[model samples]
Target: MDDQTLRRAVNATLMPGFQGPDLPAWLAAELAEGLGSVCLFSTNIVDGDQLRSLTDAIHATNPAALVATDEEGGDVTRLHHRAGSPYPSMAFLGHLDDEAVTEQVGWGIGNGLRAAGIDLNLAPVADVNSNPRNPVIGVRSFGADAGLVGRHVAAYTRGLQAAGAAACAKHFPGHGDTATDSHLALPTIGVDAATLAGRELAPFRAAVDAGTLAVMTSHILVPAIDPDLPATLSAPVLSLLRGQLGFAGAIVSDALDMAGASGGGRGIPEAAVMALAAGCDLLCIGTDNTAGQLAGIREHVLAAVRDGRLPEDRLLDAAARVGDLARAVAALPRNDRSPGSHVPDPRAESRPEGTPHLSPAGFWLGDPVHPLTAPVFLRLSSTANIAAGDTAWGVADHLAGELADRLPGSTCVDAADLTELAGVLDAAAGRPLVVQGRDLARVPFLVDATAMVLQRRPDALVVELGWPELPGAIGIATYGSGRGAATCLIRLLAEGSR
Candidate 1:
């Protein structure tokens, strides 16, 4: 790839797009000419072998192309396999509040992607989800606190990079505060730059300072900073991001097909060209563009360059940055491999073996096969009835007061001091424990750790507060807090005694 070729490749790379199964004939043509990268959606992933074959095909045509996806765990996982990777959500990781757990998840996810031969992971969402009602960023962000989310974001970036995958922190200038969805229409955040710097930008700054390889711009409008152009097409926003924040990594635009960018009445390719000229080095076509739409985007770029409407240098620079990103990603070492590769685990806890029934709650200090194990919380809250020692008691005070009255001998646990539970579980000889919370799967090891203790005792009962989709030794889903869970548990316990 010489400079001229690389330049065209970069421009093509910036014109990122996705296509469905038919793989439009023009797709091959675009690849041959250097259209940068293609993002994979759920539709693109048929099976592991098929996915690997697709990547091989892409590389065969354009060796420098960067294949990317929204492999962010939870609501936004792209490469889900019934058998391959343990698909958990960001909410699960966020609930556990354990960096080590989050880091392992990143490694697992990153490793799984590398095994599939994908290069870029547009993940570790850096949005500071301050708006609880925020339709888009719910559970996608690490948490509400800027510093906390920042720490996890940095950890995710480091872990992904460590596992030989490039991590992209996204929705620059923060999309978390908006009330509307950017997919349908442009969302405007009237926040001033200082307030944004304090709340929204902190996590991104942390990611940038940690040497993240990519930072994606949002499609939302920030009147305080760049009212004329959304962050995706605003030089001022880019200046703030690059000049003030000193982010030298590749600057990516959120999907050009998104209503926020396209709403201003520009066609897809026009948006792509504008994004590049506005300082975005990569143009994401998002995932929903039709085949005809994708081809149109390509033709638009080609026409722009041919007619001198879009300077060839702009496209070249964007592609250069993309190529540089590809080099950086390709240079990293690979993760070992995913456990089940492609076959879904029939015995996976999410899919149990028997009739839906509850198990007796007993603690096993150690082991997986033991019958009497302590109860595990699928979504643990202090409001439940699980006995806790005096020192560990009252932890649930942070959860809710209504839940506090139901558990006679149970105690509450705060999110911050959960490590104490690990220590308590370690020292217990064998006791019936009931863990709470619907987010157990997020912390794969914690679930394993809790189950390891249960194996030492097999009489463990797992209590789930949300959906009863996951499996457990003895599974119970009371659905919600309060009397429903309390009444069900009391009846189950009374029946067990009989």
Candidate 2:
């Protein structure tokens, strides 16, 4: 009956890596005490062998530790931190437009991650890219078309689940159509009921129908549902995802470290308590911060229970949901549908009873197209031209540096002086042009320059790295114009061209 133990069981963490096969004693201690999950990020991952060792060590301590990663397999990835994601983003897949192919891509991503000791993939972004100015979720989304995105969501969910890693359909209710990044500031979406039912909620409905095991909440404000609170700390919005959408899966929160959920001026510990009270089963403590940050969260959540801010039964319900998810991901059988109905099967997860499968070294993506490799993901430079630019001259230079990280020895240019930029475009000639920066719709220079380049190469891949998207590019979005995004986009472009 101790909330102390219960609180420990509900937190999912991003831990720093250790020297070798063994993790730090502190992490081992956290795992032993029933930490619900271990999240993998770029910092925590080095390569396949080291990551497997890390996960294996954690599993030894906690059988159901739920090893997961943000391996969306495109711009936003953890596995391909050092190299790059060999697979396509949801935007790329959506362009491919074949449901079976989308499922195949999802399976490939899951298969690769599972091979590296991941049991859950926080991927296949279910949000629709309905807004060009959405800074956080442009290329991460499948597409602007709701029905099409819904199809991909179900397909990707089914594929990942089939590949033995549970799929987490994310930003529940939808993070689409927002201008602000929750990481920096809270965003508000003021769509009416009809718009939500038609656009925002469609993909989630498909995800639930596809039997997704988990749904992560957005930190944005949806005045239509809950005006006063951000969705992560909003009981009404979560209830909508539960009662209305019929999602029986575990509901997790976006990282509590984000400014949106940090209670404006409040500490993260208080935010964690509110999130749990709002029906989040798993509280994601971002790995960017240390485990020390979680100590206060654990203590405060327990205090919330003792002081009646959070009901004891609600905490139990959350813990139960987390346990259910852990069991489900580990592929153990549960007789009851309720949370915590399944007891810990030490042997069940000890050996990781995954369906006999290999991490697909090379796999087919859209259509009967080319097979993709795991590491040296891209190698295409027929014209020796991968031109890149930014709206501002300074960012253009910075963008060029990042592009080189992915595309070696490619030409880089800043868009200034239409005549000079046009001359540069002429120099690129038949090569693929890569543009990085804000949404294309808002920036007149980019719009004009992109139009000029399209006259030369109609299929140039325009990417917005961690910012708004450009609408009319061959590929609508890639999360950020970093190494991961560039690698994926270049690969996609190479395959499509061939």
Candidate 3:
């Protein structure tokens, strides 16, 4: 292929989203123009059968274009709300303290994705949860312990690959200790090289050794390496993963729409250019990106290649890596298109890299599976849908006692009345403030309330009710506002403090 065509092919390597159950016409036009990939979200998912057809539509346009989704399978399954996933969050697997369990969870989740024609899973977050105040990667991570996360990272990678879906250990060079969510703002990893090498990079090391075929880069900044650019756009940072970690597979950038990528005066299109220049094989425009936005990214990257702003050789190499991933996905040994056909043998087929051989009884660890693991996979809490502030307040009051009983010196409040809430927030300013609510991004009043509280008390934490990303807050998101979720939060707070 010519440089311009290859440029369009490589540059169009975006995982953009569309509305409804199938591929919209606008996106199909762009995909025909050499768009590299498509990513599915909950909005895009109807069921496993529906997902297979959706990816088939993309395949019709470009057969080898990787159909990917963030089926993290625990708290962040893209297909679960519509169909369902058997796996829980990594925290549950981590808490289980069994690498064999983590591998089974991966196989179960991977089997679901394979049935749906989603070949690439941009998941098994390599981030270690080194900082509990991290806005994004809390329960999504295995745990705060370095060794535990590393062990499961290898296991998750092994299991997913064993189930015939390519595993991508993600947020590389680590997103574990940042206080910011890259979706909203650039998060700086403040640790030194030694600290990062020991804590954050441990799981990535394990993942690479476990033979993961792809690695996704984080948008967070690391001053220990390149102080200016985030890892997504930093050659040195990507080099560390490639050179020091010896990851010889596909390297992907986090979403270009993120503040960590587009923040600091860089636009999404330009960020895509920089990402390809920096060594990312795939430039993700994010699940929320539109057809026009994806087209623009393709156009700009092509211009960069033509004008020599991005070297042709570099783009060619990255494009080859991407093609490699597509080929890898194409080569998986599934018998049929049926999602359930690849149901992995938990004890025999989908074991982790270093996990010891186990008997069939160990599949459920000598207990029934569903009853034992339901708490980890199930939704934990719900925010009262009462639009009235006072009614929500009453609900919070009812739940506050349940949360308070779990941990001393902890309480919950509905951010309904600012004047009244401000007084309560002021009183608790000295201690850790944990605030959780639903649709936090949509509720301007709630967002403002949290921001105000954080302004006065810069140490306050905000947990989301599984909605859009919350900005400018240093806290963990439990993906729910229920009692069980609150207990998880309380446990995080208690463990973090000690």
Best by TM-score: 2
* Poorly placed runs, candidate 1 (over 4 Å): 1-11, 15-24, 81-85, 288-295, 302-312, 335-498
| lDDT, candidate 3, 1-498, per-residue tens | 475666566644566766678788887877776777787777787766887889888888888788887877545667654322334567656755777667866776677677678888988988887665555776577877889999998988877877788999989998888777887788899999999888988899999999888999998889999999999999999998989898899998887877889987889989988998999988777666676677677778888988889988888888778888888877766432221222333423422222222222211111111111101111113333211001111114444443454444444444456786676776665555556554455455666766676678664445553322534452444443322233334434443422
- Least accurate 10 contiguous residues by lDDT in model 3: 371-380
Q: Which stretch of 10 consecutive residues in model 2 shows the poorest summed lDDT?
A: 381-390
lDDT of 2 by residue, 68-124 (tens): 778775556666544444455576567657676667667667777777888878877
By lDDT, the better pick of 1 and 3 is: 3
Taken over the whole model, the C-alpha lDDT of each candidate is 0.63, 0.65, 0.67
Q: What's every prediction's RMSD, in angstroms?
A: 13.8, 9.8, 10.4
TM-score-based ranking, best first? 2, 3, 1
Q: After superposition, how far is residue 146 of candidate 2 from its true place, in Å?
A: 1.2
lDDT, candidate 1, equals 0.63
Question: Any runs in candidate 2 off by more than 4 Å, and if so which?
Answer: 3-22, 332-498
Q: Each candidate's TM vs. the true structure?
A: 0.67, 0.74, 0.71
Best-matching candidate per lDDT? 3
Which is superior by TM-score, 1 or 3?
3
| Backbone-clash count (model 3) | 4
